[model samples]
Structure formats: structure tokens, C-alpha cells
Target: MILHIGQQKSGTTYLQEVLGHVAGPLAETAGILYPASIREVLPDAVESHERATSGLLGTEYPWISAERAADERAKWPRLMARVRAWPGTALLSAEALSTIRSPAVARVAAEFAGAEVAVVVTTRSLDRSLPSLWQQHVRNGRVSTVGEFFDLLARQRDRGPAAIEREHGLHLWRAFALGGLVRRWAAQVGPERVRVVVNPGSPPDLLWRRFATAIGARHCADLPSDDVRTHRAHRGLTHVEAELVLALNRAIGEAGWSRYEGRAIREEILQHGLLPRTDRGPRVAVPMPARKRVAAWAEEDLADLRATGVRVVGNLDELQCSAEPQDVDQPPVAPEEVAQAAAAAIMAVASRDRYAPALRRRGWRARLGSRA
Candidate 1:
């Protein structure tokens, strides 16, 4: 069975839809079976098997620091069992599972899948990724300012991968990015067995061709690059609008929220959704010095990171995106200070009171509640 683990938001959706929809024709030639409930049925097995051993359940979904889960997963042996059971290649695509959760998950997953499984993955630049990621979080009601957003970035790095995974649990990198995560898989599965695809906006059939080549399913006939239907992503939010929305998120506070209620915010973004990529709005610029500090940190990490066979798509120069430095030796921006300023600005638009209840309502507290 060949497993295609998605590193999320990395064209995995497009891949899933494309692969699934064409599975019939692909299977007819490739001789693989993608049963109707493939995505549903196996993930449970992965989860249940992992849960059975780890004894930890949902402190957070996609929890990577799940030592127990990892341990349990190592012991569960379902990937192996499934591999042993299946005849043709089995493709298990869980974007969340793409990261380096545990070396064991890769080892056992590939071991059981037989010597054949090649992990197919896609990646993008972090800068290009930030805007999309912010929009995604906001859709899910995670409203963090540019400064706080960077704060979390700094913290995540200091804490290490597992910690970050348990905390934020987004960033396809948490599951699979070209860093150690993919390296671990490649190391175990063999570099040849782990095929990394450059997204480069290839047409679906082209992508399918690449995938077919990787999975040894080249025989799966395909030439209809034109007939394939591609779903253009919904319109994106303007930079200002995105900032405004996330800022409003700070006002919601931890009092409470409804899952469905946020639909309006998303709908508004889509309805009015046009990403004026050039729409520059309120920016959170860190002092130049702080940027240097972050740059230093990243360089340190990069040193270690480079030692391993991992690929970093963006430059260290770009990695300090969160640090909008004023000077070459400044401290990172403080979120509370930023919150106070932002809240005050928001209050200016509210009724006469300097302390806008709405502003406080939407602050960090609200972010916490959303997380809760």
C-alpha cells in the first residue's frame, strides 16, 4: 500500500479530490483498490489504534506531542496489518499525519505497507503561507495580531516541535514540512520511496502523472489533464480586511462563542472575498534589532536544521517575518502593549469611552476561549 500523507494546505485537498475522483480509472489500470470509505475507515483505525496505546485523547486534535499517542501508535501495528492485508498499493492520505510525529509511525507505517509505500508530499514558502494560514485560523476563530502571531512563532520555536504540535497544531509543518518531519519519513521509507512534489501550479493531470510515477502506478492510464475540474479556492480577504477580522476576534473574549456563528465572518470574507494582494493595511513592524534577534535564532536553528537533510524553501532572511524590526538590536514587540494600542485604536471608533468593552472583549481572552 502506498500512503500519501498530506502536509495540509499544500494542495492536499486538490490532490485528494483528484486522486479520489479518478481512482476508478486509475485503479482499473493500476489494480489498486480505493474503497468507497477509504479516508473514513482507516483514519479511525489510525486514531483508535494510537489512542488505545497512548491513553491520551483529544487534549487537542492533531496533537503531535502525543508521546502516548506516538508510543501507542508504535505499538498499534495497524499500518502494518493493513499493509499485510492489502494486495495492491493502499493510499492513506492524512495531511495531519504528514509531520514527523514519531519515527516509529513512519517505520511501522512503511514496514507494514510493505517495501512499496512512497510518501508523496507538497510544500510552499512560509511568507506565501502566512496570509493563507492567518485566514484559515480566523475562519476557525483564532484571532491573533501580527505581533502576537509572531510571539507565538517565537515561543513555538523555543518550545520545540512536539510542544508546538500540542499547542498550535496547525501549520502543515507540524505534521509534515521539509524539515526533520519529512526527513524522518524519507530516512525510513528510503528517499526513492518518499517523493516530494513541487506544487508549481501543475495542472491536475500533470500532478496525477507525477503521483503515478512516484507510487509505481504509472500504468494507471491518464491523459485527460483538460477534462479534470479544478476547484479554484474561494476569494481571499484583503490584507486590511483580514487584519480587521482578526482584530475583531480580540474583542469577542472568552465569554463564549458558537461554532456556526463564525460562519458569517467566513461568508463575508468569501462574499466580499477578493485578496487585493497589494492591499497593504495596518502592519506590525518590529524594531530592526528585534528582527536581528529573531534572525539570529533562526540562523541557529538553521545551522542544526541544515545538518539534517531537510529543505527550507524560504531564506533565513524571510523567516524573521514576524519580527518587523526597528533597529538591529531591538526587543520583540510586546503583545499586551500592542493589544493596548490596538484596543485604544478600536475604542476610538466605538462610543465615547476610552476603554471599549468591545475592544477588551475581543482581546487575548477571546482568543483563548476560541481555542477552548
Candidate 2:
């Protein structure tokens, strides 16, 4: 069993996107089984096998209902039975698996008892992860400011593994505190079987090829890495667009929008609508003050990662932040820029058929206006 555990936002999404395409006869010829059974979870299981891992551990998310959780848990054992029966190599890639506790880790180890299990973890520098994570947090409907989010993470950077894992909302650290994550899996599967693939943040295929090499499937490395789906892979939101979404998230809460309604608007109107228009804008970079602290924290974590003796596939030095700290503060996102972003999102939403009716447009306008 090749278990691709993830440190989220570390090219995991792109890797999973590519894997989903080749998981059938294409992968079978290469002696890899990416498993079409992932579709059993349907609407939820699109790229990664996160739902299955969530089911196996019974991990609760903010969105999962008790009934839905029960159904997911029921599906896990059946999935494992099929995996156990497969004679050749089977691959299970789930970023959620990286966050499991010691007991849950043991449960995972026991579940795959008969197979030779190798664990693969993908990692990125702390500087790169923070901004991406804050955007994701906003996308999930939270209204925390990027500054507020980074400040909290900077303070918690030095905390012990167990301490950070206990707190909710610090999900990024629970997985990307590379030393702890690698050590935990190494303890269960042995250091030799634990492979760490460092993302170089460059030519896209480099990360894909490194990942394929980690899984001992060199042939799969040459497969197409492009995400050709109608809804393409997520690109980072520009500074102005992120702030606009943050503003909209606050409004959604003030208007008491239900979870489903907020999610739909976020995905359809803000994500698809507003985001595409702002690609040329500057991306949200790590704040000057936070960069030094994160660099120091990353150095400490990488030192510990080196001590784990697990095989590393790329230059561990690539994890370091070479940019020197600057004295200037990032310019505040301009009001006009944010307004333009909002207009773009509104225009995109207005163009869609489901929201094209004047009544629906008026309804949306009224809801947002009420909060204003």
C-alpha cells in the first residue's frame, strides 16, 4: 500500500487532480491501482480519498452532519476490504490522514496489516503555506483577516506538536509542522518506509515526477499533469479579490445565510465569478514582520525533519526562506480595487442562468443591502 499523506496546499491538490484521471486501466498497466472505487463516495470524493480517511477515523468537520458521518463510517470498512483483496500495488492518497492522532494512526496501521505500507508526505515552506491557508479559511466561510490569521500562527510556531494539534482552526500546523508529521508516521511504518517529497515551487512537472518517484511508479511520472477539467484547478486569489471575498464572508454571516447557501455563493459567485477577473493582480505575499518569524520556525522544523532519517526526495534547503525582511508594511488593499473586484464578481454572477432572473438578482441585492 502506498499512502500519500498530505500537508495541504503543498501541491497535493494538483497531484490528486492528475491521479484521478489515470486511476483506471491507464494506471493498471503501470502496475498501480489508484482505484475507481473512490467514486463510491460520489459528490464528496472528487480528487483525493480524504472522505475515506475521514470515515476510517470518524473525524468530524464543521460541515458533516451526524447522519452523514455515520454513512461515511459505514463505507470505510467495505473500501478497506476491497483494498485488502487487491493483489497488486494499491495507492490511497488522502491529506486528512496526515492529521490523525497516535491512536488513529495505530488504527490505520492495523487496518492495512497484511500489506507492505509505505507513507509519503508532501511538504512546502511555511512562508508559502500561510497566505494560501488563510484564503482557504475564508473560502470555507470564516471572516478572519489575513493579518489576524498570520499573527496567531506566528505566535504558535514554537509550540510543541501535541499542543498545536489540540487547538482547533490551526489545522495547517497540525500537518505542516513537518518534523512531527514525519516522525509520527515513521514510528508506525519505520523511517525507511516514510518518504518526504519537498515541493520546489517550480516547473509543475517537477513535483509530479518527484511524487511518482516516491511511490516507485516512474512510468506514472510522465503522464499528463494538466488539470483539463471544465472547472480548472484553483489559483491563488489576488490581494484585492481575497479582501473582497473576506468582506462578502462577513456579510454572509451578518445576513444569517445557511451553510449551504453561503457555500453555493462562495463557490459559484465569488470563486468562479470574482476570481477569474483578478489573475493579473499581485498575490498576497507573507507580511514583512511575519516572514522572519516563519523562516526561523521553518529552520527549527526542518532540522528536526533531518533527524528523522526518512528518505527525502528534494533539497531540504528548498524549504528555507531566502528573502530578507523589509521595513515597509504591505500597502493596504485599495477601496477602489476592492470595489472593482466586487463588480466583477457581481457581473459574473449576473451572467449565470440560475441567477439571471431579475427576481433572484434583486433578492441577492436585497440580502447584501440589508446587511449593509
Q: Indicate which candidate wins on TM-score.
A: 2
What ranges in model 2 sit over 4 Å off? 38-45, 60-67, 165-171, 225-232, 278-280, 326-330, 351-372
> What TM-score, over all chains together, does every model reach?
0.58, 0.86
Structure candidate 2, residue pairs in collision: none
Per-residue lDDT tens digits for candidate 1, residues 2-54, read: 56665555566666655656666766677665543334556422221224223
* Alpha-carbon local distance difference test for all models: 0.50, 0.76
Candidate 2 lDDT tens digits, 36-92 = 556654734556777766676664343455667777886677667767777888888
In model 1, state the lDDT of residue 62: 49
